[model samples]
Target chain A: MTTQTKQRRKQALLHRTGSYGKGLLFMLPWLIGFCAFVVIPIGWSIFMSFNKVKIVPGGFKYEWLGLQNFRDAFLKDNNFPVDLITYFQEMLLMVPIIVIFALMISLMLNQRFPGRFIYRALFFLPVIFATGQVLSELFVQGAGEVPFIQQYNLETIVDQYVGPELAKTVMNVLEKVILILWYSGVQILIFIAGFQTISPTIYEAVRIDGASPWDSFWKITLPASIPFISLNVLYTIIDLFTFPQNPILKYIKENMIKVDTGYGYASAMAWIYFGFIFILIAVVLWLFERTMRTRRGRS
Target chain B: MLLSRLRRITFFDFALVLGFTALAAFMSLPIIFILNHAFKPTNELFLFPPRFFVQNPTFSNFEQLFLHATNATVPFSRYVFNSVVVVTMTLVSVIVVSTMAAYVLAKYRFHFKQIILSMITLSLMFAPETVGIPRYLIISGIHLNNTYLGHVLPALASPIAVFMLVGFISQIPNELLEAAKIDGASHVGIFARIVLPLSVPAIATISIFTFQGVWGDVETSTLFMQDETMRTLAFYVNSLLSGLQNSVAAQNVAAAAGLLMFIPNLIIFLLFQRKVLETMIHSGIK
Candidate 1:
């Protein structure tokens, strides 16, 4: 290469690096936070999961006992494994229900009906209230659940028809209806937002072709909303897994504060639970991609 | 699609509205229940069948809450003050940091841009429970425990906010930035003059979400703020529920406290509902 060309290329590279430096400077706060709060803590937790943690005078002391904590969580202890399985089972049923409910409500609310603002406000109100400790207290006080079951005698009727285990599951699902509805607030908002972005011209064209509303929904609306559906599915799974009411999370919290159970075991349980979440998200993403590809092929 | 047909209100529309209104009523029932309990006299709180409406609404519960607040070792107003201070500080910082980072990610061509953006997105899926213990250790290690910085710093770098802002900023036409650049505007000058003002709707939307998220947070406040005086309203309300149980007055007080914690966010939501919904729709498109 000529000397002039080489010099120009070097200057371009320098300019690129300088701009990259500026971008990094803009991102400095998030970098520091991600390192201190997210990366460091995750690394520490992984390290802690393999050891025994003890509270010392100035700080914590760790003694390495590699794989023992994981073993205890998987094989030695029963509660963590059982809780993890139950959580997965519950999420398998709950995630789809929450997503579908949100979608349906958002569709309904998307219509330009009278009192739309009121309905929207009512639906999104829960996002403000039904979070963290307040939700637990509300459920405990029977403000959200117990009264409905008692008012209709749902427990007795369901128990009479099903076996005890199935009946218990049925009752639990029934009890969770309110909580599930509460969880749909953000998803509903997202779906409604997605619905708004669907251009009216497409619907107009579909109508000119003599398609009915249902036909238009399947052909136009659903196809356009596939991205949002996947987003909502992933979001629902994460929300369910991290919910304050999840038994596995409650178990982890209990262990963290208890002297006997200790932090190492709790961290191990957290990692295992997180693994289940990762798998669930991966499965959902895989399913979503397959559906998208088939739709593309068909179209 | 049906929304475009304003002249025609069909049977399906009526049914849809009716059904959704019923659902909305059911959703709002808990809030209504809390409001009722907040005003009910102590004697009527535990009545059989749990009355949905108060027989005789009174201010005694609220009065008692104020009385307790005034007499407590750490005054109740102190919690409110702490919440306002922390939320305001966190809100301003989060908006500035997330906006700056998001602007660069959206507009600039830089090395590792993809990697940094993906990292932020991935961290969104990391459950707070998994990070709680280690985060606590870090906070204590840095001697930030019991300080507002402990509460504000960790929360200022929310990945979700960054994601949403990046999506919004990406929509701003490149031609606009190019024009500004040609006029001798530096990066900061363009960001401050063109980007910040143009991104008001997105900023407002994120600010509302951030405010509500930080305001409603209790676990972090409880973890970091060992001193009662430094706790937020959420911590105060949670403590009220857990510390005092079974007493009718306490239940009423707890209900009142929940209302106290809810009012600010409620007003904010009412004020910014349109902007929030619009920005959310815009972000969802991306």
Candidate 2:
């Protein structure tokens, strides 16, 4: 290359970098706040997770435990391993149900109906009052269960069909199905928002092409919403992981404050929880890619 | 689809209406139950297995709650005062700081932009409760502990706010911004005039969620404020849970307090819920 061309390329690079620097001016306030509040604390938490933490005057005294804290969580603790398994099972079942239900509600809301505005608002109303404390309080008062389940002796029948182990999870879901559906408020709203990407003209064209609602749903509506479906899946997973009533989190919190298992053990469990969430996301993303690639090839 | 000429009702319509009403009724159960519990007399509260609704309603529980609040050492009103100041400051800062960053991420071509956005998104998975110890240390270390600033600053690092803002802001037409620039508007001018006004739905959503989260948050109070007077009403309300754990009368009083606390959230939602639907297009998919 000529010297002039090289100089031109260098100038282009410098201009790109300089323009990027302009964005930093707007981001400075957030950077300063995030560093103090998010970055340093997360660093300390990760550091603490490796060492045995002791409470002392004025500061925490740390003893290096390396991977021992992590080991102890699985082998030493009684409830954690069992809780993790059940929690995973619960999430795997719940995420799909919530997302599908949200899609249906959003689709129904998308159609013009009498009192649609009222229904939309009514659907999201649960989110305002659905805090962990209120729900736990309600559960304590025995208001969350499916009353007919016990009245009709369905558990015995469920146990007979599904066997004892899986029956427990199924029965738990049945009892809290209404409560579980409450978690879909945000997801439904997201789907509703996502419909803006698909224009009415396209639907009109499909209708003119002799397409039925079911055909259009499979061909256009579902494809157009694949992007949103993945987004909701991730949101649902993260929300479920951090759910206030999560048994695993409760275990981690209890252990953090307890005398025997300190911050180290608790942090270790939290990291494991993060890992589970990350892996679940990765698998779903891979599935989405594989399906998309096949669809592209077929087309 | 409903823009069709015929105003027709089919079998599917009946099933859909029936299903929607059934689910709506189920969803409203907790709201009804909470309202009923708050009004129930002490005898009704102590009923075995609990009644779904109030049999003998009374206002005595609410009166007792008022008495309890007035009787506290710090007085409930003081906590409310502290929270008002903190919440106002926190909301302003949270919106200003988050939107400024969000605007850049959405519209700018910067190095490591994707990396920065992903990091902010990933932090959503880290619940506030999980980082309690480290946050406590950082707060005390910076000499912000026991101050009102500490109460407000932790919630400043809100990723969801920024995430949603960026998603909504990305939907704004690039040509409009170019036009603004051609008209001699600066970066801040275009944002103030064009971006902020257009993104009201997202702002409404952010404000509603932020208000609800901060209004009921007891984490900051528990970690930072050693003095009772410096804490918030939420802290006081939560403390009531553990303090009067065994008393049946306390349960009635607690239910009343809970209802009173929930009224603000309800009001905030009702205020912004119309725009909240319009805001949800931020699927974070783009």
TM-score of each model, in listed order: 0.93, 0.92
Cα misplacement distance, residue B255 of candidate 1 (Å): 2.0
lDDT of 2 by residue, B1-286 (tens): 6656335766666677777888898889878988898999988888876678899899999899878888877777898898888888888888888888989999998777787788897888887678888888888888997788999888887888998899889999999999999999988998899988888889888887788778888888988999888998788777876666676558887888778777787888888887877776453655
Model 1: per-residue lDDT, tens digit, B141-251? 899988899989888778889889999999999999999999999989999999999999899888888887888888678788788878888887887887767654477
Return the top candidate by DockQ. 2
DockQ, model 2, C-alpha based: 0.60
What candidate 2 gets wrong by more than 4 Å, as runs, is A1-19, A194-220, B1-7, B244-246
For candidate 2 chain B, which ten residues in a row score worst on lDDT? B2-11
DockQ of each: 0.57, 0.60
Worst 10 residues of 2 chain A by lDDT: A132-141
> Top model by TM-score, which number?
1
Give per-residue CA lDDT, model 1, range A1-299, as digits (tens): 69999999999999888988998898888778878888888898899999888887987889999989988888888787876766676678888899999988888888877778878877877876666655776775777775668788888899889866667667777788988889998898888878877999999998999999999999888988998999999888877776767788888888987887689888988888888788878989999999999999998
lDDT: which candidate is best? Answer: 2
Local distance difference test, per candidate? 0.83, 0.84
